[model samples]
Target: MSILFGVVFFILGSLIVYVFQKKIFKGITEEDVVCEVVQKAFIRVKNSEHNEHKLVRELLKSDAFIKDLSLTAKFQGSIVGYILFTKIKVGEETLLALAPLAVLPKYQKKGIGKSLIEKGHKVAKNLGYKGVVLLGDPGYYKKFGYSSASKWGIKSPVKIADENFMAIELYPDSLIDIKGVVQYPKEFGI
Candidate 1:
């Protein structure tokens, strides 16, 4: 009887602590992208996303996965948001593409996704990446300095709308005279 009481008390205490910690760290900050965290967060966030879950799994295995440039946001060590960048080629110039950026459905609109992208860009630039590209809403991505890739004569290997495929230069003139299809690694399966 005493052991049963003790177990009940312990579970109650854990719940209280979890709630308290979440409230205290509600607006979590960016953290270095950990692969395990990304995988876990993907499981949590992938349902609301358009990319196939299998594709995200495959990306993690790609040789081009720029693990160091990825970013995540956590609340009390629980990954709430993530952004991944992988190597891509546009003609002879190599760059990075932001793909599968996600935040837990419940955590959306709290600035977690925004922070991950901002941090990813900074880290990617520091790593000598010429630029970053992505396919997403222009209205949302434009705030992050991304403009239509067509402005720079860049096209996606697959046929995607011009406004949806965007690019941002990390260095001045990085896209100068660069015109061609943006080819992702075979692992991307696109």
Candidate 2:
């Protein structure tokens, strides 16, 4: 009995130490951080329609698109959060679309998603994007300056919740009077 108890305690203590080390010392490399986080998030979402892994590949390869803005959080050298933004065009105007924003199950509620979105927006602004549009929970995106796309005459090609389709103008007069169907990439299948 005494020997068995000692073995169990040793195993439990090692497991705890490993988790703590991962939580404390991990950091993501600037180049691969976003991809890693997105991959992990895809596993968590388990969405059949988007095939999140494929989407990431296509987005990275598209020449028509601008930079893929993403952010990631890491612990013990593993990414725990992610967000992705790609270019979307409306008529002659250039804008961006946010999609596949996610965080690891263990890291949810730690402001990882918020950091990703906020930093991505700033990067998009710097790169001269006029605005960003996304289909997401209003309660969440609204805090990041998103408003209903209907307000600006922007509409999704497919049926989506009215309040869920949202946009935010990066420039003061960017989307003012500019209204048209949002053309997402073919990969979106809509």
Candidate 3:
């Protein structure tokens, strides 16, 4: 009976670790991951335009909309994923928004993006952020508690499809009675 119990406990422990692998094995720090993440995002963005690195660098440097954020992932001694958030203002209130999150082509589907986002939210909540906004796939972001910003009377400053713009309130009533345009930093050019 003792041996059987030990086997059962061992299996259960392994299952727990497997299920929560990312949280259990977070191996990268914010400082170590930023440059690599920026580099990966730049490569992906460059395909869409000339001087993409310059443009992204300018955006990161100038954007006041990004705050209380950091990048993280399992490096395996090389950068394989990245995520970023910046601060944005809606009317008189400020909120954090996730933007331009990316992972290397070979690294997608490994739960890295989800891990970064989940951990990022915890950190933001710890820092007393009330809400998080993002423009992304409804299918993907919805899984993370994102909902249409329009429901809260929040819209992007630039013209964009309503479905692509979403926000999640980390705190109860974070968006209560708050409604206005979502403004990005000048570097975003939108």
lDDT of 2 at 72: 57
Model 1 agreement with the true structure over 1-190: per-residue lDDT tens digits: 9999999999999999999999986765433234334544456543334444455567777888777865667899777777788899999989898986877767888898889998998898888988888988899999989999999999988888899999999989888778899989897777
Q: Write down the TM-score for model 2.
A: 0.74
Clashes of 1: 0
TM-score per candidate, chains pooled: 0.75, 0.74, 0.71
Query: How far is 103's C-alpha from truth in model 1 (Å)?
Result: 0.2
lDDT at position 160, candidate 2: 89
Clashing pairs in 2: 26-76
Clash count of each predicted structure? 0, 1, 4
Native-referenced Cα lDDT, model 1: 0.79
Off by over 4 Å in 2: 1-36, 39-50
Tell how far residue 18 is off in model 1, in angstroms.
14
Better by lDDT, candidate 3 or 1:
1
